[model samples]
Target: MINGISIYEILTLTTILFFIGVYGFFTRKNLITILMSIELILNASAINFVIINTYLYPENLQGAIFSVFIIAVAAAETALAVAIIINLYKMITSVEVKGTELMKY
Candidate 1:
């Protein structure tokens, strides 16, 4: 237990968050909502990494380093995704996922 919270509890919460992200990603039709869901999934994994590291290897920095790397990658992914969405918006004027299937140059 760390700070009165058990690892099981933390893991459970992360699992729930991950499923929520999955659900959001699958159910949402909008591109921005899909991006938000992707962020949520990435965050859930990051949280699991940090939490496990804290409890299992308190003296090591690998978990933290990996978390930072994941964050950096996530940021870059978000930026690129937004840029794509913007360009798609300009082309189609709509951000719906199904509608984008027929996207033209």
Candidate 2:
């Protein structure tokens, strides 16, 4: 047991979260839902890094640093995505994937 939680348990939870994110991204039609799923996936990745670093190698802070970078990137991505979604909504008045198919104009 590392940090009071088993590594196996952490891995299992992360795996489950990753799959849920995948399912959400693929099944949801709304742009906002897809963005939520992407965030979930990013969170799972961040959790995995911190857990592994805390358990396997407590001497260094590389994992934590990478996690921070990932979070920063995610934030930037979210901001840009939301902006694009807003623009698309203004153009078509819908957030559905099908509605974006006409963005060619």
The runs of at least 3 residues in candidate 1 whose Cα sits more than 4 Å from the true structure, single-residue gaps closed, are 103-105
* Per-residue lDDT over 1-105 for candidate 1, one digit per residue giving the tens place of the 0 to 100 score: 368888999999999999999999999999999999999999999999999899888898798789999999999999999999999889888899987776577
Tell me the whole-model lDDT of each prediction, alpha carbons only. 0.92, 0.93
Task: Give the TM-score of each candidate.
Answer: 0.92, 0.92
- What are the clashing pairs of model 1? none
Count: clashes, candidate 2: 0
Evaluated at residue 88, the lDDT of candidate 2 is 87
Candidate 2 stretches greater than 4 Å from native? 1-4, 103-105
Please state the error at residue 72 of candidate 1 in Å. 0.5
Question: What's the distance in Å from true for residue 86, model 2?
Answer: 0.2
Residue 55 of candidate 1: its Cα lDDT?
84
